[model samples]
Target: MPPFGQGVSVTLEHLFDPGAVAVVGASDTEGKVGYEAMANAVAFDGPVSPVNPSGSGTLFGEQFVGSVTDVDDDVDLALCCVPGPAVPEVVAACGEAGIGAAVVYASGFAEAGPDGEALQAETAAAAREGDVTLLGPNTSGFVVPARDLLCSFASGVADIPAGNTAVVAQSGGLAHVLAFLSRRQDRGVSAMVGLGNRATVGFAETVRYFDADDRTDAIVLHVEGTDDGRALLSACRESETPVVAYKVGQSDVGDFAASHTGALTGDHALYAAGFAQYGVPTVEASDRLLDAAAALGDSPDPDGPNVGVVTAQAGPGIIIADRIQRAGGRLPELADETRERVDDALRGVTYTGNPVDTGRPMPEFGDVVTAVAEDDNVDIVLVYELFEAALGFPVDALSGLAGRVDKPVLFATEGIEEDMAADRRALSAAGVPLFATPERAAEAAGVLARYAGLSDRREAPADD
Candidate 1:
């Protein structure tokens, strides 16, 4: 059976099309969810109509309707920002009007108390009955960066840039934060979906969709909890797309058992075991999320465990090499040819062994990179440097070396301040990945190597 549901597949392109949109409960007041959504839609260069029973005219120079039933033109999406009690009725009207999807932004759902759960259930049932796909009952909604379309009420939409990685986050706030960080790091997003309470759609379905999405190169998930562990695991295991996840709600009770569902499923150990069994990588920190996305998105799967360390300084280089070894990455013995090249580049003062360190004030830094990168034993290369006034290391030359070499190169620099921002930008644009600390760089490399090893084994079902 196919991993996705039987409903019509919704593409990112379909979701962002500006030809048709309806904003329920749209208001002229600022800071309100409906008002913000309509304003964003208007700015998105799409056809949008505001629905408000109190008004008979247009909002933001577009026609206004009192109800979804009044809309004569085709609407691809209905952004419902109505109160929880009124959501079901509005959804039913949209279904009768043939609206394709409903982005329900109201809160009072399963995440709330029992009454909220009933309200969410009624809204979801209405969506099913109306044949409309519901995005959330308490969600920031979706954004398609390439299209410049934003349907979410998230205040941070102004910063996101269009790119290849798509994020599906369960926490509405974290979803917004992820989008902000992506933009801040210059990593673009193709699409973002915030699954609030997940009454109808689940994380597994989103993963299946992303696997088939041609624009998406990688997927990051922020999961709080889920109803069906086995089904989610199965979907991820079957997908060829790389899956990275961060699990929250680790303090909740009954987190490990199969019988536990919803908020009770917060056991960190059980989730870790499930992720390992299915070949899904689980990350803890937010900073690592960005690093993992960058590394996995660019580099090919590792061919072997061998890693080469190239540094302008001795201390940082030694630190990274030791960390790599501790993290399970091998530092193979340097080849004779490589050692000879290093010797010629460094003269006789510095050691030319594994973790090749060229002496300071070297005339040609590019040559040093080429020498270390060309080594036969190196599967991955870690470059560490410290930016200072007296030592003007050839960053461009190092980046050039990165381009020519087939192996993955990770760059780490000390003294990260506003002064080094330009150099960081240059290295980043040149496709030489940068990390703030040696430990983080090595940890990221270790994670990548571990995933590469797992990828070689026969894939297992997620629930196992």
Candidate 2:
């Protein structure tokens, strides 16, 4: 049997930085996929040629061609806005036109049934014959904010500015979900791609490509499942950049997941075990996936699973400590010297154990945090303090401490957005990720610890 889609070239640069694009099924009607695809494509930094046999005149400030072969300019990518039945022909036409890449926006193949699967096979065959790299037969396309490229039809994606995070999701909707969540959290992504149906491109190809991408610092994978899980695992294991994953279909959603993207979504427990063995940090919730990515991308990896937490309020600290311990992290007891220093700083005002709760945002809170972070036992530090305009964030102290320490220092706070905006930026600029919720911050810390443990296991010598 032919090796999976004949291993067609999925050169990400060509797909992402195409000099010019062709919309194979461009439409003039509002709300149509062709129109929206064209609408997004015109924002590209290069020329966009819309192709439709019946298309005429200009739409979205681009001239419409009768076919892909008719376009005079060299096109690197084609967005097949046509229906499922017409996609193979369009992909074949793109290959004939020397276009190296295409994104098929149509559904119906594979997930629909055996007939659809046959059609999907045909689509793949056409792509292989044409030497064309296909993105999807059922996908939402992709976005490269740094290049001012938005190939997806999804709105609000245009505003996701250039950043270091890269999202590789199996489902297009989930891709958008992570992108929008990142935007909402004021986090930007270098690129976000949806691997739909996987007629050609899948997790391994995309992950390996992004792993080498200089623009990407962290890669987040939203996995339902794949037949090529081993390849995906290999890519993750080989990636120099940090990779975080969120695998769904943990329950009886296997059929639903398969229908969504023709994924296997086999036993969730097996996937979890495989991911753990491969050293990829897996998150449970969708939002937490983005959270973990941002955290891992921005913060330094911990030396061990030992975390030192300093909270101004004991209640929230308890919540954070509980969640941290539950997530495979340890709040180890502070060293004797560390406890003494914290005691000296807090003046015995509150708990001085591993959590080191101060009861309130006291003046010496920063000093206590420093004491805990400086402790040799603590590999990571998590700080929580409510917004007290009077006390303000320990920006100067925390920034200085973070700069000095080799480990990660994460902050968790809740306050009026307007009031904390400047401090948030300051902390972020200092390489500290400030989460809005205690759970989110704690979870971020837990991921760092989890990854550290995974790394330890990976590097540990196997028993003879």
Candidate 3:
């Protein structure tokens, strides 16, 4: 069922870091589609060759080629920003020019119905004949932050920082939005690709590419619907990197999905089953997509589901505990020795059993956390700290927990002071998944536990 390993001709690197890029249908006309695409591709550090049929003057001062074949320089990638009907010929030309990959930014493909479907078929045929990996026929282009390859017309390409998370979505707009939100949450991704019409490069293949990518540590995917179930599941199963999927389109798929990529609202139940069987944690909320990815990104890979909870204020602590259980996570009973140590650290002021409430912020906050993390029972830690001067949520002191215990600690709090912002940044930069609310912190903890358990099963997968 998974036909992915069958000798794919094009190396993903050509699509990712194509040494020389050619923007087809490029011009300087303001508010024009070609104009925006050219403006965006100009940001690429590699040589960007503008291609236009008019044979007119240069837009960005680079000499324009009347067609892709006319370019003297070697072109590995073709940004097919031409109209839908014209895309096939351009891709064919790129194939003749020995280009292995192209990013098709045109719409009016399958979403436009039969004619669009036919046109998309032609584009697919061209890709096959030329051994090209076409990214999209009706989608936004991709982005690689570390390379400064902002390969899209969408705005806000400059501010994106280089990090470990990677995003692949069916919708281009959603992918960009997720990338932007991830950045806002103080998390940056290694790559962002929009899989519009799966003419050649489908979702499963994209996932596989991310899995092999050295820069990516975690993968976040947005799925509307997919035609190949085994390929998707096989990609998930093969990926050593954890995959967090934001499965959109629950009830009504709406017009955008149908018109945009001809994708229908799939059976959510079946999709959930596949994800669960493969240990892929799926989030329903759009906002939590990146939150889960960021939480899972490059830190404290917990070995078990048993969580140790700590809080300065009791109310939020209780809230986190309840949510953890409700979210199918366990708050393990503190071991006898572990409980005694926690009690001694707190000095018997508050509840010291499982959710250790310190009865107001303590100077021994870091010590108590270390005790929980070191305990035999606890595999992860959920901590809630309010802003108390010097003692409240000490980022530096808590930073030691990740290295000491080798367990993820999700830190949650509210009431940020104007002064402690840098410390907050420091904590996140130190690999602590910071959340504005207790529930989100709980969710992150749950995801970590879920992944750990599933990963163990994956290691010794049950035979069919």
Candidate 4:
């Protein structure tokens, strides 16, 4: 909408239009970029045309056009898998054909070295002159969950259900990993794009687009580095939608990182300061990306940094409580009213302070949850248990209690079996979130608290 790369103005409809698509350099060989791009397009359930001089007959049982001009239908996007030397010409043709976007999957671009930089520069110049929005010259491309569009080799494992989260990553591997993690958490994605070598459109543009997107309620980013930090930070600060970023390449890792993604490594301290200044929650670990997304999606704005721990077992509760404190979150002492409520509801042996442990075979686990939920100091409630027990605490009762409370409730179960799966599904259906481990649940709560605190602080008045 606003010139591409200026800010966050691109739209999913503009990016994933299925009116027509052309896969340049479509090949007959299996596992090649051309073949994978063509395979993804064929699986798209929309109109597609393969554009390659070598693909005159047909590929994947569809007719192949020798060139972009030969296709009678208007092309919305072009998947370019051509050689680096041929990219400019192919992009020029797509622009002449009025194609809005081109997803370049070629690798010998800026990531290759100095020669690659020159090639990448030419590619960017062609796109800018032709007015085509380029996705990547060294990328795995993007995917749209609602349209069932899998446009890259990395998206093969992405069987995403319709959901509100949109993920934009700089690494192709991380993008796929995020998608897989989201699926495991029962979280669906609206769209995912890997801005490899970011020749035309950058991560900030996608973030801004997701901010305005009706389908995208949350945005998750995996960034390596960016040439324009100010623009990226500004776009993120202005967006109403929440953003979670996981950055790599903070340390010098020999020549591997540069050759892998062309990311110019920078100081972690600088990146941390930048994130803090812009109110972007930066995650250090990969797993926390999904954790933060799940927690923020389900919870109300956290009122405080205090987390109330509830567990069937005392050991796991203590472990989680320790992790919460280690992550700079407070496990608040139960208020006088809360202690009285828990004492009245549970066995006398139950520790009635911060870590509210319902002693084994407790008669009133539900009432205990109700008491904790009512605590004025508690910003979030975390429950932990193993899946092997025959008679576990009533999760439905806990869900009901959580529903009544203004705070968010997260569960950490022990097993990965069908029983745990059933419990997760049931809790999720009741609007209570689930996590794999107590530590992960605690980490998620910490992130939620951090975001809430940052959001509460108002921005300084702008200069004229």
Arranged by lDDT, best first: 2, 3, 4, 1
**For model 1, where is the 10-residue window of minimal lDDT?**
253-262
Candidate 1: tens digits of C-alpha lDDT, residues 1-464: 64234333433333444467889999988999888998877666567889889866778898889888788767878888889889999989988988867888887676666887788778877877877777777887888777667888777685688767778887666777888888776676777788776666677777778878877777888877665665666667777777777776566544332122224555677778887777777777766676666666655555566788777778877888898887768888889988877777667737677777765546655576777778878877777777765545467676666446666777777774777777777776776767878888886676666666667432643334
Ranking by TM-score: 2, 3, 4, 1
**Candidate 4: residue 119 Cα off by (Å):** 1.5
The true-versus-predicted C-alpha distance at residue 113 of model 3, in Å, is 0.9
Q: RMSD, model 2, all Cα superposed?
A: 2.3
Candidate 4 ranges beyond 4 A from true positions: 1-12, 158-163, 361-363, 388-393, 398-404, 457-464
**C-alpha lDDT of candidate 1 relative to the true structure:** 0.73
**CA lDDT scores, all candidates in order:** 0.73, 0.86, 0.81, 0.76
- Candidate 4: tens digits of C-alpha lDDT, residues 1-464: 33334423343454565577888888989978888778877767577888887776789888989888788877788888888899998888887887878888888888898999999889888876777888888888888878767788653544766667788888777777777778866877877778888887887777778888888777888878776666677777777888888877677763676777776655667777877778877788777887887777666657778888877788888888888887667888889998888877764746888788775535577667777878888988887766654665466676666557777787777765765667667777776777888889988878877776677432533221
Please name the candidate that would achieve the greatest lDDT relative to the true structure: 2
lDDT of 3 by residue, 257-338 (tens): 6886766657878788888887788887766777778778756677888889988888999899998887667988888887
Cα-based lDDT at residue 236, candidate 4? 74
